[model samples]
Target: MGLRQDLRRGIRLVKDVMRNRKAQGKLAEALAAQPPLEPHHYRVGVYFADGKVNLYQMRQWYKPLAELSKRHPVLVLSRASGAALAMLRESPLPVAYVRRVVDLERVIHEQDLHVVFYVNQNAKNFQMMRYGRRWHVFINHGESDKMYMTTNQFKAYDYALIAGDAARARLEKVLWDYDFDKRAIPIGRPQADHYSGTLPYTPDERTVVLYAPTWEGDRGAAAYGSIASHGVALVTALLATGRHRVVYRPHPRSGVVDHEYGVANRAIIDAIAAVNAADPGARHVYDDGPELGWQLSAADVAIVDISAMVYDRLAAGKPLLITRPANPAAVIDTSGYLGACEWLNAAPDPATGADAGASMLARVSEVAEDPEARARLGYWVERYFGDTTPGATTARFHDAIDHLMAEWERFAALHADDEEVDDHDEEGEADEDELG
Candidate 1:
C-alpha cells in the first residue's frame, strides 16, 4: 500500500534525493561525529518506509527506529514528501533523496556510500547484492514479526533487524541459524513504541466491526473477486439486521481501478451512505482518528485479511474474524498470502452468504458477549502482539538501537571521503515536494 506500483508519480524517488541533499547540507552536524570510510568517507545509506506491510505497523515500528538512531551521522534515503517526512522527521537519521533509480545509482557512485539498509522493501534492492561498492541489509515490518516475505538477497544481507523471537528466527531459517556472527543481526524493531494506550470504546459499547483489506490490483492480482461489493453487501445486511454498527475503512491503496468492484466500490462515502440508509448509526474510522490505541481499544470485533490490523486487534484481546471468501482467489491468498504470519488465524468467507457470515458473527458475537470467548481471543492476541515485560522489552530494544547508532558512529571514524560525496549528490537531487 505504501508505493502504488502503477501510480504515475515517481514521488518516492524524488523525495529520496531531496533527503540526501538535506543530509549533504548538514555536514556541520557531524563536526563532532566520526568521519566516514576512507578517502571517500563512505557513509552508510539507510532508508526506511512507510513501506511496512501495513501503514499502521510501519508507523508502529519506525517510531523506535528513529528514536534509537539519533546520535549517528546516518543519511536517510527517503522519497517521502516534506510534509510526509515531518510525520517521520522524528527520525534522527539524516535523509538523502534520490529522484530516479538511475540517478540514485549515480549518486551512490558520487557519495561513495558503502552500505545500504532498507527498512522499506524494494525490487531494486536485489541489485545491491550484485553490486560491489555497497552492502544491502533488509528489515521488513509486520505485526506477527516473522521473516515471511524476504527477498532473494535475504541470506546475503549483512543484517536483518526483526521484532519477535519467532520473527527473527524465521529469517535465520533461510540464512543459517546460529550463524548470527556472520548471517543475521537480530536487533528487533525499534518501531514498536507501545502496545499501551487509551481505548477507543470503553463506556460506549455499540457492536462495532472493523473492515480492512489490502491493495493488490496493480499487476491485476487484485481482480480475482468482488470483495469490495461483497463487503458493501455485508454492511447493508448488517445494518438491516440493526444488530451492529460497522466501521468501514477500505485499504488506502484501493484507489486503483477494478472492473469488477468498480471505482464506486472503492469509495467509503458510498458505503457510508449505504450504511446510513440502513442503520443510520455507523461511524467511519481512519488512521488519523482511531490511531492504534483507539481502534484496538474501541472495537467489539475486527474483520480483516492479510492486513496488519489483525495484529493490532489481537493486541486488544478482543473478538476477531479474518474477512475472506469474497475474492474467487481468496483461498489461495489466504493460504499463502505472505506465509507463516498469515497462517496465525482462520479466515471465513463472506461470499458463503449470510449463513457463513452468521456463523462467524456468532463466533465473534460469542467472543464479544461471553467472557470465555473474550479470554480465548485474548490468549490469541497475546500470542500475536503481546511480548515480555514492557520495561525490559523497551530497554532491550532501545539499548540495542543506541548501540547500533554508536556502532555506525565508530565505523565513520575509519572513513575519509567527504569531498567525494559533494560530487556524488549532484545527480541525486530530488525534484518533488516532500511529504511531511
Candidate 2:
C-alpha cells in the first residue's frame, strides 16, 4: 500500500511541474504585452505568496483594493506564477509577478509602498515582512471564531485590520501582553460593501438555501467539515423538497486531505446536477465560482460549518444555521458568535429512521421565519461587523489606510537623515521550486 501511494504521489508531482512551467510561460507572455508599471506609482501593496489554490483569499480583496486605489494606488505582489496569471487576467488592481526574492526586492526599490497587506498566514509572507520602512498589516481573508483568528502569528505583523468588537475581544482572550490599542484596528468588514456578482438563476417563490461548508481540516482539532457528516443528508433533503433551492458552495480545498470527504462533496454536486436535470425550474446550483456575494445576499437561509462562511453569511444580517461537527476531537470556541449561533446536528434519528436532511429542512424553515433568531442575528452582525449600513465599512477601511499613510509620512520625516539600511542580506538564496 505504501509503494502504491508513493507512485501516485510521484505521478501527481510530475503533472504539477509540467502545469507550472506552462503557467510560467503564459504569465511571461502576458506581462510582456502590458507596459511596465511606472516607478514609485503604487503606495499600497498586497502580498500574496500562495499559489492558485488560495486565490479566493486574494479575490475577496479585489473590489475593496480597487476602490482604495483611487486614493492610494494599489499593486498586488504575487509570488506564484499561477496566482499572478489569474490576477493579471481578472484583478482590478495591477499585479507584479515577483516569483523570486530579487524580483520582490526590485518592486520594493521601485515603488514607495508604505502599507503592505497580507491576506493569509502563508510562511512565505515572512520573506516580505523582513523589509522595514513599511507597515506589514494582517488583513485576513475573512472573519471567523476559528483558532486561526487568534493565532500568535498576529503578533508578527505591525498591525492587524480586524472586523469589529468581537474580533478585538477574540484576540484579547488568546494573545498575551499584546497592545490591542496600538496593533489592532477594527475596520469592520469592508468586503461587505462590495458584494459583487450577478444572480445565476432567476428569483422565484422557492426558498434558496446556501450550504457553504469549509474544507476537511488537516488535524483533528480543526475537523469542522460537514460534507461527510451533515452535508449529503441535508442537501438531499433540500433537493427532494420542491419548494427549496439549494446552492452548494463547498470549500475550494474540500477533500484535499481526506478521500471520504471528497466522495461526499462529489455526491452533493451530483445530487444537485440530477435534480436540475429532472426539474429545470428548480435551478439547484453547484456553485464553485469565484464570486461569493450573490449567494450570501440571495439565499433565504445559509448553512455553514465552523469556518469564515459563518461570519461571511452573518455579515449579510440574514438567517443561517451552523453545522455541528460530528468529530468529537473538533475544537469549538463558544466565546464569540459560535456560542450563541443556532446549530444543526449531524445525528440520524433512529426512531423515525430519518436522516439529517429531514431535520435540516425543519431547522431551515424555523430559522427563516423565526423572529427571535432574526433578532439574534442582527445583534451578532453588529457585534462582528458594526454598521452594516451600505458604505459604512468601506469608509472605515479607507480611513484606516489614510491613517497608516499619514503615520508613514510622520516616521519617514523622523528618519529622513539616517543612513539607509539594506535588509535583503538576510533573504539568502531564493527557492527555485515553483508551485503548480
Candidate 3:
C-alpha cells in the first residue's frame, strides 16, 4: 500500500515538472518573437515568478497597479515566460518575460527602477534581491490572519504595504527586533476602493449573501478552510431563506490539497445550481471568475473563512460571519478582528450551543435591522482599515508608493557607486562578443 502511494506521488511530481517544462518552452518561443518592453524608466515594478499557480494574487493588484502605471512607468516583471503571457493575456498591464537573470539585470539597469513590489513570497525573488540601489517591497495579495501573514519572510523585504495596525501587531509579536514604523507602511486595502464588476442579480430587494471560503490549506496549522465542513450547511440555510441571494465564491485553488474537500466543493456548487433551476428567481450564483470587487461591494452580508476574505469583508463595513475551523489544529488569532467576530461553529461550542443553521439564520435576521450590529462593524473597520471613506484607501496606497520612490531617489543619489556595474556591463559585452 505504501509503495502504491509513493508511485502515485512520483507520478504527480513528474506531471508537474512536465507541465513546467512545456510552459517554459512555449514562453521561450513567445519571447523570441515578442517586442521589446515599452521604452520607459519604470519607477515601480511588480515581480512575479510562479506561472498560473499564483495568478489570483496578481488579480488583486490589477486595478491599483494599472492606476499606478498611469503616473509612473509600472511594469510586471515575471521570471516565467508563461506567467508574463498569462498576465498580458488577462490583464492590460505591460509585462516583460525574463527567463534569464541577465535579461532582468538589463531591465533594472536600463529602466533605473527605484522600487520593486512583490505579491507573494516566492523563493525565486531572492535573485532580484542581489541588485542594489532599489527598494524591495512586499505587497501581499490580501490581508489575512493565516500563518503566512506573520512569516519570517517579512524580514527580507525593505518595506511592506500592510492593511492597518492589526498587521503591524501580528508581525511584532512573531519577529524580534522588527522595525514596524520604518519597515511597515499602512496603505489600507486599495482593492476595497476599486471593487467593481456587475452583480449577477438585479438589486430589487433581495439580501445578497456572499460565501467566500479559502482553499483547503496545504497543512494542518493553515487548514482554516471550512468549505467541506460548513459550506454545504451554511449555503443551504441561506438559500432556504428564499429572500436571500447567495453568491458562492470559493478560493480559486479550493480543494487542490484534499480530494474529499474538492468533492464537497463540487457538491455545494451543484446544490446552488439545483436551487437556481428549481426557482429561477433564486438568483443563486457560483462565482469563480477573475473579478472580486462586485461581490464584496454588492453583498449585503458575507460569510467567509479565516483568511484574507475576513479582512476584505471587514473593510466593506458590512455584517459578516466567520466559520470556526473544524480542524482542531488550525490556529485562530483572536487578538483583533477575529476576537470581535461572530462564529458559526458546526459542532456545538460551550458558549453558543446553537447549531450552524440556527446560528447563521439568527445572525442574518439580526444584522438586517440591528443598528448596533452595523455600528459594531464600523469600529472594527476603523481598526483594520482607517478612514474608509470613498477614495481614502487608494490615496494612502499611492502615497505609500510615492514615499518609497522619494526615499529611493535620495538613497540612490547618496549611494550612486553602490549600483552593480558588472552584470549590466557584461550583458552589453556579451552582445558585442556575439556581433564580433
Highest lDDT against the true fold, candidate = 2
lDDT of 2 by residue, 1-436 (tens): 7787688678878988999999989998999998899998999999999999899998888888989999999999999888889889989889998888888888999999999999999998998998999999999999998889989999999999999999999999889989999889999888888775788899999999999999999999999999999998899999998999999999999987786799999999999999999999999899988777888889999999999989988998889899999999999999888899999987766766766778677878989999899888888999999898999999999999999999999999999998988877434456663584
Better of 2 and 3 by lDDT: 2
Q: What Cα-based lDDT does every candidate model obtain?
A: 0.48, 0.90, 0.81
| Candidate 3 residue-wise lDDT, 1-436, digit = tens | 6787578678877887777777666666766776776555678888887767568889889998888878777888887655666676677677776666777777776686788999999877887877777899999999988889999999999999998978888888999888888989998999988888887887868888889999989988889888899888778788888888889999977876786788889998999999999999888999988878989988888889999999888888877888889999998899878887877676533467777776766766776667777788888888878889989998998898888888988877788786455544343323210000
The candidate 3 region of ten consecutive residues with least summed lDDT is: 427-436
TM-score sort, best first: 2, 3, 1
Q: In what order do the candidates fall by lDDT, top score first?
A: 2, 3, 1
Report how far residue 343 has shifted in candidate 3, in Å: 1.0
- Expressed as tens digits, the lDDT of each residue in 87-155 for candidate 1 is 334444444444344445654665655556665454444533444434565655454421234334556
Q: Where does the lowest 10-residue lDDT sum fall in candidate 1? A: 336-345
Tell me how far candidate 2 lies from the true structure as C-alpha RMSD in angstroms.
Answer: 1.4
Judged by TM-score, which candidate is best? 2
- Model 2: CA > 4 A from native: 1-4, 350-353, 426-429
RMSD of 1: 8.4
N/CA/C clash count, model 2: 0
